[model samples]
Target: MIIHKSNNVTVFQSAVFQLNTTVVATEDLILVVDPGYLPYEIEQIRIYVDKIKDDRPIYLFFTHSDFDHIVGYGAFPDAKTIASEQFVTNNLKGSQLQAAINYDDEFYIVRPYQLEYPRIDFMIKEDGEQFQVGKTLFNFHYAFGHNHDGLIVTVESENLAIVGDYLSDIEFPFVYFSFEQYGRTLKTLKSIFEKNSERTLITSHGTVTSDQSQITKRISDSYEYLEFVKIQGSGEQFEQFMEEKKYIFSTIFRKRHQDNIMVYERECEHS
Candidate 1:
């Protein structure tokens, strides 16, 4: 479906091909975010980049260290791959990267999505630190909670934010709370929403939201879901109950739970 392009920047997102892929072009460089699942999807992005950006030195950015977000990176060897310092430090090991070569285990499972470990450069981006590629300027901010160092990039000129798994339509497979830290991060994202209430948000999955109200609603609902799990059921029971919701979130939730039921137990203990 090539999920429809969102307004604001010269950004184009691919259809649901594992992890959603986004390409943001300026006058010169072509920056692609999360190169989907397969080589073919990356190839599609390559073709598009060639046609539009003249195949200029590509800048590939990873939102986190997850395999789905980087399965196809080897396809673009010449591109400069950038990621958060935390993700780069933890995931750059051959063992860590290869452990995810197949969806066999949790914490390090790499699905058979055409795996690749690209050369990564670490750039610790925080609020207001701008990443400039050609004419486009993307400012980074913390959208943690989903990942220890998750990032949300805002295209300054266009007023668009490229938020990765930070805001998933997929109900959190399990609550991810680092005690009060996760709570603070969620609050930070809410504040970002309130400040940029009129800007458009390009989520890692599903539809692009033009209204902050939608972001607010989704975050609130996800938190509610987490609370529901904490109060209503044990980790296993919450897993079964959430399956009943039947939204697209259910699929990811089920898969995650199937992979790591203990993660939920840990989260419950923390809460």
Candidate 2:
């Protein structure tokens, strides 16, 4: 667990767990973004929050409701949790938690970690509205397509945005919920990044970026990589493509297995 300072907040990098949790603190409050996997880590985060600003009312915001992102919610009992209405309606309830567990067990070969239903505070902004916590105002932009309810949070004070899985060192995009709008979403994000080149973009998987050129390049590369795979004919062709594109492949290969390969194949066959 390595913690890096991001102007007024701290971003905790979880390499082993493959998630990045961020904490934003103000004089009277603490705002935590996208708590990751591991019940123990969540407890640690709660303890940290309490120690630093005792009973300051931690606000847990879910950028999206993927298994890795929400597993820690159980640890923050007193805090209020907010997320896209679509996420809560579709995937954050009790039955949804069971479904998530089954989904992981069948596909990712992992059991769903325990989860606490967040307070169900509010809906996502319809037109990129802003949510204020104390002195800082965090802008919530609806940038779906990677997932139907995905969001990007921009902090007004730091000139930085916490973009969850919108970009990564990984070559291909892992989108669930909607595939048809994936390309358009990437384009939208690229446009936003271009407009805010001086503002830092923090991805869940890797480094903070201020370079729009690199962000653009990564998105382009990700799309191109997926396109190349889509061009391949079948599952066997996908295997060959993977071998050829070994330069861009990562541990996401074997573990994610059929999902990672089939998604590209589906894009080729359908898109």
Predicted model with the maximum TM-score: 2
Give per-residue CA lDDT, model 1, range 188-236, as digits (tens): 6677777878767677766677766678877786666556544645466
* Candidate 1 similarity to native, TM-score: 0.78
* Top lDDT model: 2
Runs of candidate 1 with Cα error greater than 4 angstroms are 6-18, 91-96, 103-115, 125-128, 173-181, 232-252, 255-261, 264-271
Worst 10 contiguous positions by lDDT, candidate 2 = 109-118
In the range 1-271, model 2's lDDT, one tens digit per residue, is 6557754677777644457788877765788887765545656666677777666778888877666777677667777777877777764466546655665466563323454455567677464778876777877877665566677888767777787777775435665544556677677677767777777777776666677777777688667655654554445665665576453443555434446456656655775
State the displacement of the C-alpha of residue 106, model 1, in Å, after optimal TM-score superposition: 15
